[model samples]
Each structure stands twice: as structure tokens, then as C-alpha cells.
Target: MNKTFKIYAVIFIVVMVILALLEVNKKEVTDWRKNFDTNEKSPFGLFIFDHEAKDLFKNKLKKIDQTPYNYYNTHKKESHNILVVETEVDTESWNKILDQVSNGSDAMLIVSQIPKEVSDSIGYYDSEISFADENVLKLTDKKYKNDFIKLDKFPSGRGFSYIKPQVEILGKTVEKNNSDQANFIKIKFGKGNIYVHCEPLFMTNYYLLKSGNIKYAQDVFSYLDDKETIWFVESNAKVSRFFMRFILSNPALKYAWWVLLGGLVLFVFFNAKRKQRIVPVIEPLKNTSVDFVKSIGNLYLQEGDFHDMMAKKAQYFLNKVRLDFLIDTQNLDDEFAKKLQLKTGKTIEMINEAINLIKKAQDPYAHVMKEDLARMNKLLDEILK
Candidate 1:
């Protein structure tokens, strides 16, 4: 096989091997499909505490045991109170539900990490909550003057304060906006209320089992009391928002996507044919004697080396002429000289001069005078003519 084909074959084999290995590794993962969970799991496959928090919520609120939404819809005889915990709140589905609770007869309680984008879209008021004697403004237009509760000191040092249970906040509270101590917030919007925990780690399976934060988690959800709550365990809306922002912000990424699409188009355009390969016929090589002689003659002319080259040519022509014309070189003073004189109708002096010039011209180094070399070439040409 040719070198290119061998290299391509090796590369193809290696790529296939790598892909196979990756597929096997992917299959080895316990919960690969759960990678997209917003709160329950992170991108790196680590299960965040939010999943455990959801389970704890399910166990604590017996009414929402089967499904949070189902329980919310079915619990109509009593006060239609609902609770929602989410990583982000932006989807129209979530908004529609919130609107229903706010405008309808139900009272809703929502616990979530409200992304800034969603907060901005809904036009919520901004407020900051502070720790270590620092003041934090609330996001809502309406303000609440209250003492800050130290989260580190709660439930045997694992619990934090719930603040005033029902308050209005216009702007959203984010985990990044507040200090590490700023873990949770409670907001009242329209007729529904929201309780957001910035860091959901305390509610995770691992932390709940070990850190004794289960009591705090229970307290956070139990505020709904006997009210049915909808626990929407969905992916973070912010991730999608962030991705949209990135695509909109980076012109190069947009161009790169276009370039990739163009390449795919070209690939499809070129490889549409399904033709078979045809064997090529090889031809035999021929000798190049005539070509070599002509090339040498051209080289000699271009270099103006006529005196030296023509001496060789003249010698060859003289040998052939003598043989063909049946002239005897021996005794050239009589027989050969007379025959040469008759054949060319040239003077004996000129023929003799030609012979002497050919001998002298054979050696280029012997010709010191430029005029002698020129005369020699002229005489040789005349003899050949």
C-alpha cells in the first residue's frame, strides 16, 4: 500500500479505538442520564445535596409524597397552600403556576435560588441582607427592619435563621451576591410567598445523613405545614440562560458554528458519488539516446563552446565522409587530397587547414588566443559545409 493509505488506516483504527473506549467509559457511569439535573447534580457527576433535600421534603410533607404537583392539585378541600423549591425560576411553566397561585385562591410558598436574569425579567425590587453587623438591603420596595440570624449557630451549629417568614422583595437573592453566611431568604410576591436557600448543600443526602442539618431542612419545608407543595426537581434555568448569553456575547463562537456547518455542506457535496475504482495501466519505458544527443548539442551552442564541441563533431563527420566517399586518408597528399578536393570542390590548403584546426581545437586549454579559436570554428564549419 502507498504511504498515505497506510497512515490513514492507522489513524482510523486509533480513532475507532478511542471512541470505543469512551463509549465503554460512558456506560460505566451509574447515572449518566442525570447529568443535566440543575440542583441535584453538578456537571462533574457529583450529586449535590439538593437531591437529598428533595427526598427529605418528600418524607416531611406526607401530603406531597407521590408527586408535589399532584398533591397540590388534589388538596382542594383545605386551604390550597403550595411550596416550590428550585435552583432558578424563569420558565413560562413555572411562571404560569406562580401566577395561578398569586391570582387564584391558592397560597404558594416557593424556595429557590432566583437567578439575576429571571429577577430582572420579572422586575423584582433589590435588597441586600448582611452578616457580621453589615446591613443588607432587601430586593423588594417594602423594607423589613429585623435582627440578622446567624446561620452557623442553628440546630447544634448546622441551622440558620428563617428571617421574618413573609416579606416582600423586588430583586432576587443569589448565592454569589450574599456572603457565605447569607444562605437563605424569604420573600412575599403578590399573594404567594418564596423561601430561597442560596446554598442547597446542607440538604443533600451526604450532608443530611452526617451534618445533622436534617432538622433544619425539615423546619424549612414544614413551614408549609399541612399544605401540599410542588417540588419541581428540574435543571437550572440559569444554565440555559448562561449558554444563550455566551452564544450572543461571542461573535467568534457564532462564526465557528457557521464554519462547521459550511464544512459539513462541502463534505456532503463532494462525497455524494458512489463510483468504483479503476485499475491504471502502466506503460513500458523507451531509450533516450537521440534526446541525450540533442540536449548536449543545445548545451554546447548556448555556452558558445563551438570550437571545442565542433572539433569532436567534425572528427566524427570526417570519419563517416571518408568511409562513405571511399577516400583514402593514407597518402592524403595524392589520392585522399585529390578525392577530398573533388568531393567538396574545396582547395587542398583549406582541407589541410581544417584537419589541423580540428586537432588543435580538440584541447580548449591549448588555445590561448581568442582569434585562433574563432578561426578554427570558421574553418571547421566550412569543411563540414
Candidate 2:
């Protein structure tokens, strides 16, 4: 029976190991970022730029894969149309973009969420999510006013607006009564212009595939047609973060990393034996109670103060009697003797002898001897027993 149980346990462990290896090697379905990148081929990717959009724009569209700061710093004072398709930008990137736009270059910023720096500078802010029952957009331009293009139900409202005195309202929608919510605005920065369009989803692969939705992307490009180069910037982060994400996204590598972590834990548990130096056993310093009492007794004996020694011994004995029997020792008379004898279950003669010796020791003129201390010690031992 014991052999059978051992065989079954080993079989279970072997099966588990096989299953883990199989799981680690299993293939996973393709997972795409679904971002508004011009290079991706996912359902939500903008692969059209790699194929049709670049061709339509005369192959002048350039993809800027680095951070905005790096790209702008490297291409300082260069004239180009910049297209940023992210919802938010850091303060540094935002300032650099503003500087570029102010330097006589056209820029089209398509976003759903607006950063605080840009919102304050452009006088535009984000509104609530827009859920239009109809899949159409009402264009503000008179040329496209009659043209209503199909749009997906955007997760958030493309509501970016500025004061009419400061910026131009180029596009709007009539989703609510008595008000036309602005979805696009054009701001004149310095010698150039910065166009802020809230509906970037219209450029996505899913929306572009919809019937008559490509026209929306076409109109967006129409604003940047004068420039020979159009820089398409993607969302950026630190290099280390990108590398970690790349590693974690691979199933095989992720599993191997987990296995390595498990091996490390086992190594630390089973084989992490380091030779340590021997620690010397330190005996605690000896208690000085006995030495202190001996020193005091020797001093009293050398001074010939036997009476004081006897008084101290008597006081210590009385204190023990007071504590053990809960009796007062202010007057160590017959009452104390009777109490001590009753509490200790000792003979009255023995209790009386101890008490009489204590009383005789109280006189300063009394000559206490070794025989008296011996008798007193014997009397205390008898009473304790």
C-alpha cells in the first residue's frame, strides 16, 4: 500500500510538470495596441497611412517615432506640418509644440482629452462624453455643411472649444438643443496656425473602413496640404518602460522569466548556505547581589559594629514576616510572635526565641556574638520549615 501511494504521488508531480511546460510553449492570439499609429495593421490600427494615405499625400508624410522633444530639438527651425494623435502631452512637449507652431509651421492636434497647459493657452477645454444616436457629424464649413459622414460612438465627447474672439470655430455638432457643441477649433499662434480637432477616432482603422468615413480623414489632411513634410508623432515614454512592456508582452519570455524567478527562490531556500564566522558565547556578567552583601558584612565586622549588623538582620527578618504573614512589625512584641507562629505553623517557643533575639539586637550597647547569629539563623530555619 505504501509503494502504491508513492508511485501515485510521483505520477501526479510528473503530470503537473508536463502540463506547465506545455502551457509555457502554447501560442497566444495576436494582441495589438489599437493605438492611432500609422504603422500598425490591427483593426484599430492606421495602416492606411503606410499604403494609401502616404501615396495620396505624394509620399511626403514622415512618421516621428521618437519623443516630441527629441524630434523638435533635432529639426529646429525646420518647416513642416506636425500631426500629433495623442490625448495628452507633458508640459515640456506641449511647450515645444507651441514653439514650433509659433515659428510659422502648421500643426493639427487631434485628441479627445486636452492637457491643462494646452487647454489654458488655446482657451479650449474638454466636455462630457458624446453619445450621438445618429452616426453622423455636422460640419461647420459651408462646403461640407450638407455632407454628413458616419462616425462610431466615441467613448468620450470630442468637445474642444475656445472663445470666438481668440480662436476660430471650424467644426461643430448639434447633439443638444439650442447649442452647437464645438468639435474642432483653429487657433492662430504667431505667423502659423494650430488646428485642434477633438475627433481623432475618425482616423482610426475601424472608422476609416466605415462607408464614407475616409472623407473625414481627407478633410483633416486638407488643412495641412501646403506643407511638404507632415510629421506624424506617436505617444512616447521612457526607453526602459518600452523595453519592459516588450518583454512582458511575449508569452514565452514572460513564462521563462517566471521560471527563473521560481528557480531563484528555490536556490535561496535549499542551497544558500554561507559559511559564517563562529560567534563567541558571552557569559552574562555575574550577579553582584552576593558580593554586595559580603562586602557590607565584612565592613561591619571590621568596624566591630555587631549591633548594627544584628539590627540589619533583624530588620530584614521583620520585613519578611510583615510580607508573608501580612502582620505589622512596629512593635515586635508577643502579638507578632503569636501571629508569626500561627501563620508559619511553627511552635510558639521557636517564634518567641527569634523575636527575643531581634529585640536584644536593637540596643546600641549590646555585644552581639557569632553564637547569637547562629542561634538566630537556626530559629529562622525552623520557623520557615
Candidate 3:
């Protein structure tokens, strides 16, 4: 068993070394999911946008980590230039945001798909999103109308229709069919104004990294008033443990984790034991009470302790007489002898002789000879019979 264990240990060590070397040379793959979190530096994340927005809005820029309803409810009397760059919205929160905007606050919402509630309320509709490798976009104002931007290599733009009355068309895109569509619009409600844009991806980290594509994002923000702005951005990236972060930072460590797990599973399989055989039943020892008493009697006889043996014999005889005759033997006077005679129907002479022998045996200092012991046993037999 010891030799087998040593062999398995050596084999396991070799396997682990080989696995570690292979994992160390493995290459990592790129992640291509759209997270849009301010903390994430992925291709579709908003890390670049969140960092650069401070320059545009200055010290007035703050982040909202809660729902619009929660923020508005807590700070009911306060208002700011609100910027919402989100794909999904809670209906109640969106309505509350619109209510806050109408009361006094200005808001700019950049979303690819406008919610049905907002579209219906404003009598605005957008055309189906179109995909292209390159597209042309420009503002409506005459001074910037000639400043056209070609957002290249992406499904990055869309068009609009049913723009309704009393709305200002801020920006537009020329579709592949050579038809123009409204991409950005503004409407005044109560004491404030709202700007809604159709192509929200143009504001992400991808467009900001490009040389001239940043002009479009800047031109869009130029419409907002220079009020203190609160941005509602994603805040879902959680703090993680250092050990776990270290393991996940490298592809090699991730593969080593799998290898170690497989090694543990193999070790458990090889060391598993089957149920042991049923234990055998054992018989208890036999009784030896008579043999033990005989052995003790022989030891006393060998030591010549005749007086002590006679004293014990006298006690047993008295106990037997009391139990058999139902008589008290505390006093061994004439009454006990008379009672023994009556129970045994023996002669008075015989009973008296046995009682005298028992008294002599009970005396501690009496020298009990073999002849005296024989005579006492003979008399006791005759009286008890």
C-alpha cells in the first residue's frame, strides 16, 4: 500500500507540472459584450464617455446611482440638467422623470429605441433601425448643416418620422435610400425643454476614441444649458476579493484552476474504499463460582488456618438453623438449643452436644485440632438430620 501511494504521488506531481506549463503559455480571448458601465473598460462600455463628460460639464457633473423616481422623491424641491443614457427604463420612473422635467428640470435622453409611453405622449415615431458600414449625420442649424459627419463602420444610426408640430429638429441622418430622417429633436414642456436622440451608441466609448467622430457627441451636448447636470449611468460593477481578481486577471490561472479540480476528483476516485466485512459474533465466558470457592478453601487449608475456618463454619451452621427453623439465634443459650431440638425432633443430649461444639469453634483463641473438628462435624450432622 505504501509503495502504491508513493507511485501515485509522483505521477500526480508530474501531471500537475505538465498542466501548469501548458496553461502558462495559453493566450487570453477578448470579451465583446455590451456592458455600458462607467467602471468597465470594455469596447462597448462607457468608461471613456464618463471620463470625458467631466470636461464638457465641468464641476457641475454628478452621477445618479438610483432610479429617477427615488432621486426626485428624495429631493423634491431641487432640479438639475438631467442626462439619461440608458437602453431600458422603468415605466413609473420614466413618467416621474418626465413630470420632473415639465415642472422645471431640463433633460437629454439618448436612447436607440424610444419608449412607447414617451412616443405616444409627444406624437413622435422613429423608423426601423438601419444597418450600414458607413452613414452621414449632420445638425439642422444652417451654420452646422454643412458640417456633415460620416460615422463609419457600424450599425450606428437610425431615422425618424411623424415628428408632429411645435418640435424643433436638431439633427438628421441620410438613409441608404437617399431619404432624410430626423435623428434628434427637442420639445418645450411647461417651464423646461427636453432633447431626445435616436442613436445612443454614438455617445459610447467606441465613437469617442475615433479622431473626428467625437465632434458629433460634442455637437449633441452643445444644445444643453450650462446648468448643473446629473448623469444617470450604470453602476453595477461590484468590488471583488483580491485573490479572486488575481486568478481571473490571467488566462493561465483560470486553466490551472480546472486542472487542479480534475486532479482532486481523480485522487478521490483512486482512494475510495469498499464497506468492511461483517464483524464476527463472540460468546461470553462461562460461570466458575463453585471452582472459585474451592480454590479459596484449599488456600486456607494449606495455611493451616483451622480456627478461622471453624469460625466461618459455625456462622454458616447458625444461619442455616435460623433460616430452616424460623428461630432467632442472637442468644445461644438454652432457648436456642430447646428450639433446635423441637424443630429437628432430636434428643436433648445431641442438640446440647452440637451447641457446645459451635460455641467452642466460635471462640477466637481456641486451638482447633483435626480430631475436634471431626467430632463437631459428626455431632452437627446427627442434630441437623
lDDT of candidates 1 onward, in order: 0.47, 0.69, 0.76
Q: Give the winner by lDDT: 2 or 3.
A: 3
Looking at candidate 1, the ten consecutive residues that score lowest on lDDT are 150-159
Error of 2 at 170 (Å): 1.4
Q: In model 1, which regions exceed 4 Å deviation? A: 1-3, 22-83, 103-183, 187-192, 235-385
TM-score between model 2 and native: 0.55
Taking the candidates one at a time, how many backbone clashes does each contain? 19, 1, 0
lDDT by residue for model 2 (293-323), tens: 8998788778976666677778888787778
lDDT of 1: 0.47
- Candidate 1, residues 21-47, lDDT tens digits: the string is 776565433332323243434332224
lDDT of 2: 0.69
Question: What TM-score does structure 3 among the candidates reach?
Answer: 0.56
The estimated TM-scores of all candidates read 0.36, 0.55, 0.56
lDDT string for model 3 (1-385, tens) is 4565666667878997887777777665544565566776666678888888889786789888888778778876466788888646688878887887788888898877788877766666665655445777779988776566666645455667777778889998875765677889998876788888877667667767877777777778888888789887655556452435777767999889879878875774566433347999888787899899999978987998777777777788888888888889898898788778767888989888888878889888777886777777777767667
Q: Model 2, 165: alpha-carbon shift in Å?
A: 2.2
